[model samples]
Target chain A: MGDISTEQLAEECLAIVTENAGKKKIKAGDLQKAMAAKYGDQVDRKDVKAAIKELIDSGKCVYGYFGGSSIELPHVEGSAND
Target chain B: MADDLKIPLLEELEKGPWPSFVSDIKSVADRKPMAADLLRQLEKSYEDKRGYWKHGGLVGVMGYGGGVIGRYSALPEDFPGVSHFHTVRVNQPSGWFYTTDALREIVDIWDEHGSGLFNMHGSTGDMVLLGTRTEELEPTFRALTEKGWDLGGSGSDMRTPSCCVGPARCQNACYDTMDMTYQLTQNYQDELHRPMFNYKFKMKMSGCPNDCTAAIARSDMAVIGIWKDDIKVNQEEFAKYLDDGFNVQEFVVEKCPTRCITVEGKEINIDNSNCVKCMHCINRMPKALAVGDDKGFAINIGAKAPIVEGALFGSVIVPFMKIEDGDYEELYDFIDRMWEFWDEHGTARERIGEFIERVSLATFLEGIEMEPSPKMVKAPRDNPYIFYEEYFAEEDEGEGEGEE
Candidate 1:
């Protein structure tokens, strides 16, 4: 198993972002679809959720919990958050 | 002259050989009455030696808030022409070489929604459509966007990159600078259109060392073409130069700073060991000397006017990086890496160069996964010693040999 590349992660992240483009809130399922699209049948939903958590930790992605839905990838400061 | 009764001399002195912009403004003043009135105020202020315009304002055309820049005025009714004179900077095609139809479409659109007057190109290399009303901004932007056109930088954003005529017209080009410029522009439309950074960013590309675009002095990020191999000299071409009354001794051999060339009869032998690759000799003898086969590129940073820091000329960062197929994937990744690092640490209004200087180049390079070279010095400064210093100092000992 090779180390997870940022390019692969970014591609998955972009897909997730596009699906939830206009939505006020997103969910963990969005990340699963993103990961599925990239790794096909290999990526598990749990791993996808973990990647989102990593993005949040790196300050590259943000999230919010509202109305029982987790809105991942909120705007980061000093970046094109909007 | 009374306060309001004086004609401006600066306005009258517009007719001159020194490339006066006042004359250019006056040409449009007649067609547009409002423009004429604005010019009168401008001239009056010039005569009074006072600034006619204030800096900050909100001026935009209708529809989109992002598309139209909003510039308001303290006295809107008085200076009607300039009060809400919002300019729309349309991202121009790379190299600014547009087909007849593309140009016609843009002009037609501008004529319909905004003022007929155009600035041709703006400071950020965009087509500047001046004097549009705030109400028409969104509609105009939508119309342009529908036609596959887009707005360029105005405030703090990534500005459109510009390049000189490369393989399109010049034979000396090593890469398609124009195409690369367009690709970079298109790929980063979000950065170009949106205000994401602290201050405006500028990028420029040039075909070769001729520097036809003046990228070295003007842009914050400059991509210049270079060749890594030694100079190619044609003996036959050297003979032609000599036959044409060119002084081989005085002009060619003696003029070489490194004493790299030795002209013996028709044969001009070059010592590759001593050559500095300055391109001075190639410039002098174009036909005889050519650039090497192993072509590459160099990256430069921090070239801009004095603002937060003193003016800086670009210093070479990547001394000699291979430009494989001119695809520049590595270059693109490098840019992404730079943005990731800078965007994280940079404050509002901080340029990449300023950030690098503040944090130190070593740290910046480490973040970007690049190594620092000896060429990457602090900054360009004048060296006190000249070439003959050592020779002159040792002349008393009589240890050196004379010219053979």
Candidate 2:
């Protein structure tokens, strides 16, 4: 799989975020690390960041800088739990 | 004996060659007491070196968030007539077309409810009815809206979309610029009335690369009509042009950006693909040369007034895309994506051009799913061959190695 397209990375990112949901805000850095570990050298950091932006922009997830260093998904009002 | 009311510093404004705003106001000041007081307060401010007016807390009408900018002067107790002079923006008709009856009706309404004065058309293409009281805003809005007038945008929302007169009047028009502008304005009412972003957004359209609206410099996003094919040249017209004072070598041939036009004895040949379609030839020889058949728009991004930074013209993002059926879903999606990214990340008072400057053009292109093209590159790159991100992908691939 040639770097698992940005669309695919976005899906993987969402799944990772969902699993980490309700525990705490999913850290952007941690999410990048997890994707890197899973995909090896197929994906670059910029592509991962772009994927994360796509996820947030698409409303599949919400993003905000948590504690100023890392961006995390914020809770939405009407979304079903988990 | 008006010297008693005049401040000497203001008289200096009238001494210049050009017509003075001070003098114009003075003419109106005789009949309008508020205008007299406005001049008085302005003179006092120049003397005192202070602002005579102040902005109040957010004031708006029922079910609306924008289109009214509330202003109240601190000198209300002294100049009561000029106290609550708020600005109300009424959306203008497409291509600024207005019948005499419509014009008279608006003027009559303004005369009844507002200060009789109105800006024929504001810079944002709105009919700016200046100097009205807070109490009169709703009734004025009601009267106008009842007669099918709506408000233009203000605050942090999308400002009114403006366009040049297109196929209706001009021959150079490649697309229906007026209809495009009207369609965008009508479809995006929510974006106009609702102040949801960090700053204002504006869209402007021009029928052709002539850019009558100056959309590239004045708007946040511009859809300038363009053609992808060769320039249409008329041989018969070319001969007449040659008979006249038309110097094909001095004006048209030399001015061609790509040196695409060749003029031999009684014959002119153009390399169609090499032509940049800059309209230099078309403008120089109006009868001889014309625009091509295959037409569309070149979408651009990041134009704005100099606020947080210097004024910047929007750069070409997509060189050409056909705008069919007057449908602009692609353009709208591009706008939405851009707004989503900017609204989430932009700082207060930073225009899109300034924001793009902070974030490299590469990031914006990536975010918008647009691959960088030669048209999007404004200046010559240090390495002429290395174009877009793909060129550096191999170099980026070397990044995941562990430390030695």
Q: Best-fitting candidate, measured by lDDT?
A: 2
- Candidate 1 global CA lDDT score: 0.62
Specify the highest-TM-score model's number. 2
Listed per prediction, chain B TM-scores read 0.82, 0.87
Q: For each of the candidates, what fraction of the native contacts does it recover? A: 0.00, 0.00
lDDT of 1 by residue, B1-404 (tens): 12232335655676656765556556666555445545656665666777554432233322111234444333456666665555788888777888899888887887676655677777557788765665667777888888889877655557778888887986666577888788888777656644444565788888776666766666777777666556788888889999999987887678777788888888888876456555667778989988676665567776777866677777666655555555768778878888767765765567778888889888888998775545453433221011132344354234221100
> First chain of model 1: TM-score?
0.57
- What residue runs in model 2 are displaced by over 4 Å at the alpha carbon? A1-82, B1-31, B379-404
What docking grade applies to model 2? incorrect
User: Tell me, what's the RMSD of every candidate?
Assistant: 11.4, 12.0
